[model samples]
Target: MHIRPEQAGDSHPIAELTRRAFARAKHSDGTEQDIIDRLRKRGKLTCSLVACLGTEIIGHIAFSPVCIIGAHNQHPQWYGLGPVSVIPAQQRRGIGKTLITQGLATLEKTGTAGGCVVLGDPGYYQQFGFMPSPNLTYPHAPAQYFMVRSFDSNIPAGIVRYDAAFDT
Candidate 1:
């Protein structure tokens, strides 16, 4: 399997993969594709990566800017990682992991020390250093579903907000 930056042509395949991956979930809201569309329109999709086996896109991941505001009115650096999807047929093959690791490494190389936030299973994300943020909260989601991983130790704590597109 090869991991590479997603190109323009990968959109359709990626969408299909996302749909298939989330179709059977109890919480399928059809919002994953919407989020990707909005992020693309806003040009805030920092790093979109895909894991491929030959010409097929088996997995995908995206990172976009997020902000954390502290009680003292301090706004620290951060980004949100989300909507990670692996084609249902390929779920256990580590494609999601490859996409995430590659995407994060690319973000770090670009001087993004703001860290990353994700709404996901702690058991899975913990493997990548993500943990619940004691200093932050997401009103709409359970606290346990929200997590943060600091890429730099100096980032301040604050309310985490994703781009407006996420609200759609």
Candidate 2:
């Protein structure tokens, strides 16, 4: 298996993989794929990565700029992680984890080390240093499901807002 940055032709497969991965997820709103599409259309998809087995893309992860309401309303020092998808057949094989690790590392290198937030099971995400942060929030989602990974130990206290596409 190879993990790498997404290229020109990966979009369609990424969308398919996303749809198939989240189609029946208990917490999915059935719009996971659409979120990514909207993120791209609005030019907010900052980092998108894929895990490929041979010539086929099997998993995908997307990261986009997040706005910190109140105090730190400036250039994005943070990002949001979501719709991390691996085909049903590929689930439980570490593909999602691999995509996430690679994606976060790439984002950190880009000077976005402020942090990244994810709405996911703490059990799965905690291994990556993600923890429930009452300091940050996404109002529409359950607070307990919101996890954060602060790179510089500077996790800000603010209302976390994802791109407007999330509302679409």
Candidate 3:
């Protein structure tokens, strides 16, 4: 299996994969694909990657811009991760982890010091250096679900807001 950046033609299959993966999961809202579509249309899909086994797309992950609003100010440089999906049949094979590792490496290489954030299991994401930021918060979501990881350690704390596309 190999992983690579998603291409234009991969949209349909990736969407289907996302839908199927989340359909019966614990948080199935049936909106992940819509969020992805909106993010792509808005040009906020800063990092979108897919795991391929030959000609099949078995997993996908994306990262888009997020902001933090602190007591003193708001930061708009940070990015957020989300809506990561792996084909149901491909789950438990580490495809999601691989996609995240590669995507984060690419972001760091591009000098994205603002770092990445996500709403996920703390234990799972902590392996990637993601932690709850005392200075940051996502008021709309559960406290534990909002987490961040700074690539440069210079990003300030504040309310983390994902791109508008995520509202879909």
Candidate 4:
């Protein structure tokens, strides 16, 4: 399978894939797709990637800017990664991994991103260099589930506020 940036026509399929992918997830509230749509509408999707086998899009990942409100009052180019999805039939084939790998690589290449934060399983995200930092926390969730993968040594400490689209 190949991974590439998402195109305009891939939106609907991505939505369907996201819905089916997270339909039964223990932590999903069933609005993952809607979050994507809102992010797109608000022009906050910093990076969106899709994994495809031939002409079919099988997996997807999204990244958006996140605000880090710290005591230092520094707002770096940090981003949030989430809603990664692979169709149930294609799950566990490493499509999700490929999508994340490619997406993060793209962000790093741009040299504009400070790092990325993800709210997910520590075991799964740890492989991607994501670790819980006492300095950075998301108040809405447990500290263990919120992980950060800094591109450099400077990992900020503070409350991470995802885009307003995620508030719902």
Candidate 5:
């Protein structure tokens, strides 16, 4: 298997894989695939990576800019990570993990990102240095399930607003 940035041809495959991956997820809204499409259309998909075996795309991950709503009204440079998907057949085989690790690395290397946030199982995300902080929150989910990994010393205090596509 190989991991790489998503190519033009990977879109539909990624969507199908994502749909299959999240079909039974406990917290999925059943629109994960549509969210990706909307994000792409809005030009908000900052990083999209795919894990492939041979010519088939088996997993996918996406990172997009998030706004930290605070006193200043606009908190730039922070991103949201989510909707990571690995096909049912490939789940637990480390494909999602690799996509996430590589995606975060790509974001950090940009030198513009202050941090990344994720909403998911604490046990899984913590291994990647993501932790819940009283300083940051997401109004739509339980605070503990929302985690943040800051590249720098500062983890801003505010409500994290994901892209509008997430509203789909």
Candidate 6:
């Protein structure tokens, strides 16, 4: 699959792909599509991307700014990675992984100081250097499932808050 930044024209197919991908997921809120829509409408899709075979989009991933509480009132340049989805028929073909690898690599290039966080399975995310961070927390998230991959030695310690777009 070829991975590329999501263009505006890809929104509808991506929404459909996301809806279908998570339709039967264990922890799906059944609103993954809405979340993506909200995020995009708010201009919070920091690095949205798509995994495709030729012109057909098969996978999608998104990143958005996150706030680190108690960062001493300084600007927190953290990002949250989530709602990654690959079409059910395309699952396990490494499409999701490819999208993640590409997205995170792109995040690294933004000179992000607070790095990235994801609420996902440890088994899968660990390979990408994401580890459970005791110092950083996402409210109500299982400690082990909420992970971070800091870009620096001094990892920020605080509550991680996703954008208001996630409020719904």
Cα error, residue 48 of model 5, in Å, equals: 0.2
| lDDT-best of 3 and 5 | 5
Weakest 10 consecutive residues, lDDT, candidate 2? Answer: 67-76
The TM-score between candidate 1 and the true structure equals 0.91
lDDT for model 2, please: 0.86
Candidate of highest lDDT: 4
| TM-scores for all predictions | 0.91, 0.94, 0.93, 0.97, 0.96, 0.95
Candidate 1 lDDT (Cα, whole model)? 0.80
Q: Which stretches of candidate 5 lie over 4 Å from their true place?
A: 71-76
Top candidate when judged by TM-score against the true structure: 4
Q: Rank the candidates by TM-score, best first.
A: 4, 5, 6, 2, 3, 1
Measured on C-alpha atoms, candidate 4 has an lDDT of: 0.90
How do the residues 1-168 of candidate 6 rate in per-residue lDDT, one tens digit apiece?
A: 788898979999989999999998988888988888999999999999999898899999999989898666554488999889999999998888889998999988877546899998999999989998788888768899999988765578889999988886
What does the lDDT read for residue 41 in candidate 1? Answer: 85
CA displacement after TM-score superposition, residue 5 of candidate 5 (Å): 0.9
Per-residue lDDT over 1-168 for candidate 4, one digit per residue giving the tens place of the 0 to 100 score? 898899989999999999999997888999999999999999999899999899998999999999888648554599999889999999998888888888889988888788999999998999999999999899888989999998877888788899998988
Clashing pairs in 3: 69-159
Q: lDDT score of model 3?
A: 0.84
Cα RMSD for candidates in order: 1.7, 1.6, 1.7, 1.0, 1.4, 1.3
What value does the lDDT take at residue 135 in candidate 5?
88
For model 4 the TM-score comes to 0.97
Tens digit per residue, CA lDDT, model 2, 1-168: 899888888888989989898886887778888899899899988888889999999999999888888745444488999879999998998888898998889988877458899988988999998988877887877877899998778878898888898886
lDDT of candidate 3 over 1-168, digit per residue (tens): 898998989889989999999997886689998899899989989989999999999999988888665536544377888789998888888888898899889888887346888898887898888888777788987888778888878558567778899775
> lDDT tens string, model 1, 59-117?
88989998664546544457889789998888877778878787777877777456788
**Ten-residue stretch with the least lDDT total in model 1:** 68-77
User: For each predicted model, how many residue pairs clash, with residues at least 3 apart or on different chains?
Assistant: 2, 0, 1, 1, 0, 0
